[model samples]
Target: MSNYKFILSGGGTGGHIYPAIAIANELKHRFPDAEFLFVGAEDRMEMEKVPQAGYKIEGLWISGIQRKLTLKNLMFPFKLISSIWKAKKIIKSFKPDVAIGTGGYASGPLLKAAAGKGISCVLQEQNSFPGITNKWLAKEVRKIFVAYDNLERFFPADKIEKTGNPVRQDLLEIADKKEAGIKFFNLDENRKTLFVMGGSLGARRINQLVEKELNFFKENNVQLIWQCGKLYYEEYKKYESDLVKVNAFINDMKLAYAAADIIISRAGAISVSELAIVGKPTIFIPSPNVSEDHQTKNAMAVVNKDAAVLLRENELDEKFENEFLTLWNSEEKREMLGSNFKKLALPNATKDIVDAIEKLLKKAA
Candidate 1:
């Protein structure tokens, strides 16, 4: 009988939360007796999301350092010290067999505490460019799971494993794209469909650009599946039409991905990973609002490889309609982009990451 207690930590966004959950779920499947605990930043989305996933979680009074020197920056040292102390208490009380961090603000302190206790710890980094938190955790971590190649520049060569990002299991299978997807959205088969998602809370800049351009699709006999996300739903819902479907959230993203002839989305790490798996012609409108301009870097990874097209958020008003129309008119170019993206798909990422964790667990034993 396998006996293991696991402590998983990651948060701040769905990119961090989902990968941690994916790894936790995979761990539970292989070790039914395992006890799982999630640690996240206090009052963050993960505090709500992790519980809904049927896992117990703890929170730290931790937030990311501000870009500018402010009062929040002054509190950073205090928060870090408090979070480490809290993490140590949690780790000691739980006596976990191993700790895994999926990369977020809370993860740094949690993994640091775990490693200091001489507990085996692993970290999963989703971005092509490693985040500051993961880069700092690189030395203490026993194993590192990565989504992109050439990560050896950021991490130790021996510790890095190119496991790809673990996306939701449901997204792996693209079944009956025409009938299932069209039926789900009540969309017409005669028109070409575009799926636009700008992340869960929605990108205000993307929403503004889409609001301006929705009528163009109506005139051109094209259709749209627009997930405006929760934040901008009310403002954009009035623009919905027979050809232009507006949603606050898409519960079945696989269906949305299947139905889309083309996709417009934010280029967050998780979104890029899912797009690679979905293998659709995607125009990535990278948000300038994020830290380190990571979205632009994420999009460029695909655009440089001919797997996607990139439009900066600042330049959306100028370029979105023209570039989107150019792609819409050319089916051959769309197919080329989709095919090239499929080459980067790592469908077995979840299994690969779980395998890495198990290897460490065995070594610790």
Candidate 2:
């Protein structure tokens, strides 16, 4: 096997960062002698997270441009040019065999520069709708690994592959980790565990809803593992008790998934994909703040499959309690939802994505 040098770019959130890290980890396992570098937005979560994942990273002076024409839009060109110039320098120095992007504004300049240098490039699109960066780079990259269907309208039909998003492989073992998970989170094995995920920064609306419903949960005798995210940690950490374990972020999702009898989550692409693999009955509260309202679409995709329940922000007051109660009371309903969700999981997504990268490397060679 060739000792390849790889550059993976993407990150502003855990959604993009974790996929790139997962792909890099898989590539490292396959090519032990390989070298890896990550390019993400400056001072963003990726700078801190990529290093934590045991990889080197370079930060670009870029973030997403506003949809509307504004002063912020004026700054985009300068940021883009600066990022492109820096990306070229990184490419010239590293001379990577291949470049991979996992769909974020951070990847745009880096992948564009890498492609311009004739370095083989591949991309991963996590949402049902494509991000602006991936859509712009679609024509240049060798392949696009997508998680949703009907992406052919936005990407080249020949280059797009439905391999799903690369997720932490440890999730596959969640079934057997229930006992260990119960111990790890210090929860009573007798009480049903409810795992609440609001992303790396946490969801404000979801946090409020969870807080308001604490009395209801107590009445139901449910224990919780709540990942309120860094931004809201201080605001909500005071609610922690013997039955309620609150965290700023969850470092070990495998155990968290194992501990969940039912899950409440924001429907970011990576979180949705991970939930599908965890095969737990889930309630999706997708953020309306995302571009194109894609989080709602992501939740609807699973809901359309009868694999999860969705409560829109506007409807949560009227619908959340009824929906939660219906699913919570019915063992049969939970089983059906979990079973259907698991059916949508692509367990080999990471390996298959790495396989595509290997093929690209071979062709470049």
Candidate 3:
């Protein structure tokens, strides 16, 4: 009954990958004898990151079907068939007590195969607007853990649980990281620092917005730690100065959160969750390009609560300066935003999720 084996399938982006790792870490802490195997897309970020988290992982030859009809889309049927077979083989050999999916392309085939074989399967959806993969797997999963309300619109009402998304352990205790973070970034102790991140690959629109607003940061007496993303580093690196630190990608996000007085970011689900935890005054510019307008829905959840400010991509040019100035000029508003936003944070999410997973494990036992 002990020494349980588990399969965690999710990846393609940090949003999906980190939650899976967070769940795995909590399970490992609670049951050191447990064995874990992660399945992710062969050439994606999870293939690299899962190993770095000190776990064994296997990659499936899978990729998501594109929106438009193309060669990749045409190959979807074959890719899916190949992946399902590979996933079945992995599940058979692993014989997991439970299978947990955090929502990604790989999770679709793997979880479907697990559920087919009568394994306990659960899903953790980080976005307010669930992705296509999670939606497709909704009927098959025994339980679905979600971050936002009103998910019954898409999921089975009885099976849905409102546990917030799991965050990495390093992000949980940031009260003491401020001084270390300031030192780490070589930021001026006297100046207000603004941290800007657009996810892992970087946000092109956000980066363009930042580029145009460099002088505005100067006028407000703000210093910046801007993660312009790897795609735009060459384009934006020329703007870095004593007052600005430009990064292609940031590995040390805990410190990045600690060093910032204010944050400007995209409204991806994981970013929103972490920002709530960091409890910093933030302005979210949700990406318009995302499916189902997912970022906007995620950002609106916080904004509607008066916990944070949100600006659509279209509104940035007309309203960005004024919205930012309103926050910057008023210390009370900054504190209010940070404090109210913190009210929405669920710091114990990882523990809660693991507890539920343990219940599913007992059922299978």
Model 1 weakest 10-residue run by lDDT: 169-178
Give the per-residue lDDT of model 2 (tens digit) for 65-130.
Answer: 898999879999999999999999999999999999998878999999999998899999999988
Name the best candidate (by TM-score). 1
- Please tell me which model should have the higher TM-score, number 1 or number 3: 1
Give the CA lDDT, 0 to 100, for residue 202 in model 2: 86
Measured against the true structure, the TM-scores of the candidates, in listed sequence, are 0.98, 0.94, 0.95
Residue pairs with colliding backbones in model 1 are: none
Q: Give the TM-score (vs. native) of candidate 3.
A: 0.95
Evaluated against the true structure, the overall lDDT of model 2 is 0.91
What are the runs in model 2 whose C-alpha is more than 4 Å off? 68-70
lDDT of 1 by residue, 22-86 (tens): 98888999999889999999999999999999999999999999989999899999999999999
Give the runs in model 1 whose Cα sits over 4 Å from its true position: none
Candidate 3 positional error at 25, Å: 1.5
lDDT of 3 by residue, 1-365 (tens): 55999899999888999999999999999999999999999999999999999999999888987789999998889989999999999999999989999989999999999999999999999999999999999999899999988999999999998889887667878989899998998989998899999887899999999999999889889899999999989999999898999999999899999999889999888889889989999999998987789989999999998889998889999999999999988899999999999989987888998999999888766
Question: CA lDDT, every prediction?
Answer: 0.90, 0.91, 0.92
Give the lDDT of residue 278 in candidate 3.
90
